[model samples]
Target: MYWPNCGKGYLGPGGLDNYGKYFNCTGGVAGYIDRAVFGNHMYKHPPCQKLYENKVYYDPEGILGTLTSILMVYLGVQAGRILNTYVNVRDKVIRWTTWGVVTGLLGGALCTFSRDNGPIPLNKQLWSLSFVLVTSGMAFVVQAFLFMIVDILRKWGGRPFFYPGMNPIILYVGHEIMRDTFPFAWKPTTETHATYLFMNLWGTFLWVAFSIFLYKRNLFLTI
Candidate 1:
C-alpha cells in the first residue's frame, strides 16, 4: 500500500525525496533528514481529502521496511549456511549460483513495467517482493563469485571490501555523518553527469580509505 506520489511530487524512485519541488528528483541531505525524521512529505494532490492522504503512506522507515530488511538478512544467513555446510567449494558455488538464477528469473517474471502502478515494480522505498528477490539474487551471485575467487583461488585480498564488511555499522554511520562535509562531498564546479559521478565515487573511496585505516589499526565497531 503506497501512494503514487507523496505530496507535490515529494517522493521519487530509488529512495529519493523530491524536496517539495521536482528539480531532478534529487533530495538534499537536509531534506532527507527532515523527511526521514519529521515526515514532512509533500504530495502532488491538494490538501483536505481522504484521511489516508494526510498519513505517511509511503513510509520506508516503518515496520514494513524492517520486515523487508529482515527478509534480506534471512537470505544472507542462508548464504552463510551454504558456506558452513559445504566442505566442497564446488558444491557451495553451485548451490549459490543455482539459487541466484532461480530467484533472479522469478523476480524478473513477476515485474511488470508497462504502467507506473503495475504489478511489483522494483521499488526500494516500498521494498516490494520483486525488489527483494532481485537484490537477493544479485547478492547471492556476487557472493558466490567472490567466494570462489577469494576463498578457492586465493586471487584477491579483499582489502577495502572486507574492511568495510567487518565494520559495516560504523562505516555506514561515519559515512552518513560526513556525507555533506568537505573532502567527502562538495558543490561541483560543473553540474554534468560526469562531475556528479566522480564526486560520488570519490566520496565512496574516502569511506573505503577510512575503513582500511581502521582495519590497519585493528579497530572495529560492533554492537
Candidate 2:
C-alpha cells in the first residue's frame, strides 16, 4: 500500500491531467483506504470496477496478486491430482466438467452481469478471486476438451501446441525478451486494428516456428 511507485504516471481521482495525485498517498489515511479498496495503478488501465467508484486500480505484482497466485497454483495442483486419480477418460472428463462448471458459476456469482463493475470484479492485475476461479474453471474445461479429443477420440495430434508445450519456459522467456523487437512488434505506419492484429498473429507464428525448431532438435527446457 505504501509503494512509492505503485500508481506513478497514471491519472488519479483529481481527473485526467492530475497524474498520481488522487489521494494523499505517501502513508495518508485516504491513500490507505483507496489502496485497500482498489489495488495500485489507476483508472486508465483495466479490468476496472465501475460500480463503487469505477476508479479501482490494478497491481499485477502486489500483495493481492501473490495471494491469488498461490490459490491458482493450488487449483492447478488439484486439477493434476484429479487427472492422476481417474484412469477412465470418461470419468476424467465428467469430473473436470463438473469442477469447471461449479467453479465457474461460483466465480460468476461473485460479480454482476457487467464486466467492469460488481461486488467483486474479475480484475487480473489485482488477482481478484473471481478472475482466479473463472480462469481456472476455463482451464479445467479446456483440459477436458483436449484430453477427450487427443487421448480418447484420437482425432487431432496437438501439433504446434505439442512442440511449444514441451518447452513452455523457453517460449515464454523468448517471447518476453523479443516482444518489442523487430518482426514481433513495430511502430505501425497506420494505427489500425488490422495492422495490430497482423503483428500479433505474426509474432505468435514466429513463436510456433521457434518451438518447432526446438522440438526437431530434441531441445527442451524444464524445471
Candidate 3:
C-alpha cells in the first residue's frame, strides 16, 4: 500500500491493521486520542463528555452520562472476565441487537432527514446506545477485513501487525476534521445531537465499506 503522510490519507486494506494493533493494546482508542491531541499536538481536544454531549435528553448531558459511565465501568469488569473465558455470556440479548440497530438507524435517519436546518437533541439514553452498537459492529467488520488482508500478505511473506497506536489518533484526527471542516455544514452549532449522529453514521459506513473492500481483496489485519 502507498502511504500518505496523514491518517486521513491512509487507504486500502493494511491501513486498518496498521492502526488497530496500536490502539487495541493501549488505552484503546480513547487513550490514543489523549496522546495524539495532548502529547503530540497543540490544544488539548475537548473531553468526551463535551464532544459527545447528548442534547435530546438530560442523561449524560446532566447526571445520565455519569450514571451510564458507572454501568460502563461495571461492564468493563464483566467484559474482562468474559474475554478471558471466565464466563461465557448467552447470546440472547446481543443476538437481537442487530434488529435494534437497524430499527434505530432507520428511525434515527428518518427523524434526522425530516428535520430542517437546526441542532438536534442528544437523547443519550436512546441515541447514544445506537452510536455504541453501530460503531462496535463497524469495528468488528473492520477487524474481519484486516484479518483477510493479513492472510494474503502472508502468501508473499510480508507480515504486518495492527499496532497499538492507531485507534485514538484516527478518532482524534476525524473529530478534529469534523470540528474544523464542518462537513455537515447545514448543522447548527446547537445541534450537537445531529452533529454526532451524522458523524457516527458516516464513520460507520466508511469503516464498513473499508472492511468489505479489504475482505474482497483478502487483505486483513493480523491481530
Candidate 4:
C-alpha cells in the first residue's frame, strides 16, 4: 500500500488508510482480514507523524513489510533449488539463464503496466509487489550472468567482488563509520558534482585495495 497523499507535507492519512483502500480494491478476503486487524489498530496507533514529515524515506508498512521480504527470500531459495538440482551442467545453465531473462522481462512489463494503469505505482518505499518482481528479476539475471562467466566460461571471475562479499558486514560498517571522515570525505575547492564523484571513486578504490590486501592474507570476517 502506497500513500501518495502523505509524506513531507501530509500526515494522519496513515498506512492503514492507504493499504485498506488497496486491500478493498485488490486484497479480497485477505484484505478484509488486514483491514479488520490493521485498520482498527490504525485508529489507536497512527503512524509517526514527525517521522513522515522529516524523514526523506518513510514507509508506513514498517515491520509488516517483512512479509513481502520473506517472499523475496523464498524466490531466492527457489532459484537456489533450481541450481542445486541434479541436472546436466549445460541444461542447468540454460534453465537458470532462461528463467532469469523471462522473469526480468515479465517484471519489467508488470512495472510498466502498473505505472500506467493502477491506484498504485511501482515504488521502492512501499516495496510494492512490482518492485519486488523487478528487483528479483534483475538479481536472477545478474546471478546467471556471473555464473555463466565464472562457472561456465572460466575465462573471468568475481575476484574483485569476492573480497568485498567475504566481509560485507565489516565493509558496510566501516564505510558507515568513516563516511564523514577524511579520505572518504574532503572539502573540495570547486565543490562540483564531479568532485564528489571523484572523491567517492577514490574512496571505493581504496576500499577495494584494502579488501584485496586482506584477501591476500587469507583474512575474512563473517557473522
Candidate 5:
C-alpha cells in the first residue's frame, strides 16, 4: 500500500529535504510574504508561527535560493575585479555606475516580464532568477551610489553605514539576540500594525546607534 502522506516519503522527488519540508510545511519566506502582502490565507502551525507546508506551492527546499546567492557572490567578485583593474578613478566610477544602471534596468525588465509572461515568477522564497536579477541589480546600484558619495566626494556622510558594514557579524548576531530584549522591544501601547511597525523602526535605529557607539570607541570585530 502506497500511502501518499507517509513520513519522509511524502517529501516527493523535488529535492525536498528536511529543511525544505520545514519551509514548505511551515510557510517559509514565501508563505509569510504572501500572507502579509497579498492577504493569502497562510496555514499557521502553533509554536512555529513563520512556517507552513503546502505541497501545491512547490520548491520547498529552496534550491533556487542557494543558486541565486551564488549569483550575488559573483556580482561582488565582478565589483572587486572592476576596482582592481581600473587605473583611473573616473574610469572606475563610470564603469561601476554604468554597470549599476544597466543591471538595475535589466532586473526591472526581467521582473516585469516574469510577472506577466514567464517561466517563473519573481519569488523571494524560490529565489527565482527574476528575483535574483532584481535584487542583485539593486545591490549594484546601491554600491555605485555609495562609491560616488564616499570615494568620489571624499565625504564622511557614509560613516554610519560603514560602521555597521565593518562589523556585520557582530551587528547581525547582536540584533537577533537582543531584538526581543528590553529597550529594543517593549510593550506596545496598542496591538496595532502601526505600533509594531514603529517598534521595528525603533529597533533599527537602536542598532544604528549602537554601531555608531562602537565606531566611536574603535571597537571593530573582524573575522
Candidate 6:
C-alpha cells in the first residue's frame, strides 16, 4: 500500500512516472512497508493486504519517514562537504571514512526497528533517506582512503581519474574476486551486487584513484 504523494517521477518504481527515467527505484526501499514492494510479488503481509483497498495506501502516521529522509540527506551532504573541503589527505580521508561507516550503522539500525504496517509503518521517505545516508556515508569513507592511496602513489599524473567506474576492471574483475574468493558470498549476478549495500563500498574503491588525482591537481568532474 505505498501510495506516493510525490507526483511525476517520484511516484514509485515501475510506475508510469519513472519507466524510462535514468533513476531506477527497486522493488524494495528502506523503511517502506512490504506492501510497497512485495505487494506486486508473493510476499506474505496480512497487514498490507488488509490495507491495500483503503483510499490512502500508506500509514496515516508515516510522515516521519519523509522527515527522516530530509535529515539524512542534509547530514550526508554536509558530511561530504566537510571531507571534500579538506586539503590534507589524512584529515579528508579519516573524516569521510568515519561518516560512511557511521551512517551505514544508522541505516542498519533503522532496518531493525522497521515493521511492515505494524504499530510502526515504513514509507518511501525512509527508504530514500536510508539510501542517501548509506551512499553518502560510504562515499566519504572511500574518498578518504582513495585520497590517501593516491597521495602515497604518485602515478596518477598529480590529478584525479574519475571515469570508467563500472568498467570491466571493476564489474568483471573485482566482482569475480568477491564471488570466487569470499565464502558464501552473496555476489550480484546481474545487478550491482547481491549485497546491494556494498554498492558504495565498491564504488569508492573504483573511483578514489581518480578523485585523488583531481584533488592533487585541482581538477574536478563537473557537469
Q: What clash count does candidate 5 reach? A: 9
For model 6, how many clashes? 13
Candidate 5: pairs in clash: 20-61, 24-53, 25-52, 25-53, 26-51, 26-52, 26-53, 27-51, 27-52
Each candidate: how many clashes?
A: 6, 0, 28, 0, 9, 13
lDDT of 2 by residue, 12-102 (tens): 2222213435433322223344467765553344322221123444333455566778999998998899899989878889988998998
Worst 10 residues of 1 by lDDT: 46-55
Model 3 quality (TM-score): 0.30
Query: TM-score: which candidate is best?
Result: 2
TM-score of each: 0.64, 0.68, 0.30, 0.61, 0.63, 0.36
Candidate 1 per-residue lDDT, tens place, 1-223, comes to 2222333323233221223233322222223443566564543332111211232223344444557678888988999999899899889999999989988876776675322333555656556567788889998999998997888889997876888897899888988998888999887786565777898999989888888888899999889
Clashing pairs in 1: 6-43, 7-42, 7-43, 7-44, 8-43, 8-44
TM-score order of candidates, top first: 2, 1, 5, 4, 6, 3
What would the per-residue lDDT of candidate 5 be over residues 1-223, giving only the tens digit for each residue?
1222333312222224355543343323433334445443433233122222234333332443566678878887888898899888777777777777776667667656555334334655556566677777776667767877787887657766777887788889998898779788877766565777798888888888988898889999887
Q: Write the per-residue lDDT of candidate 4 for residues 1-223, one digit (tens) a residue.
A: 3333222211222333344332222222223335545654532232232222221223345443457677788879977987898367776667666766776666667656555333334555445556677678777777777878898889787888777887777778889998778877777676554777798998888788878887889888886
Worst 10 residues of 2 by lDDT: 9-18
Superposing every Cα of model 2 onto the true structure, what RMSD results? 7.3
Model 2 vs. true fold: TM: 0.68
| Candidate 3 residue runs with Cα over 4 Å from true position | 1-59, 87-165, 180-200, 203-223
lDDT of each: 0.65, 0.68, 0.37, 0.59, 0.61, 0.46
lDDT of 3 by residue, 1-223 (tens): 1122323322111212344322221222222333444553422222232433311111212233344356445534543443355232233224234434554464345335332211222233223333343434443334334434454335422221232122335434545665534332234455465676777667555544544555557654443
* TM-score: the better of candidates 4 and 5: 5
Instruction: Answer with 2 or 5, whichever has the higher lDDT.
Output: 2
Off by over 4 Å in 2: 1-58, 187-201, 217-223
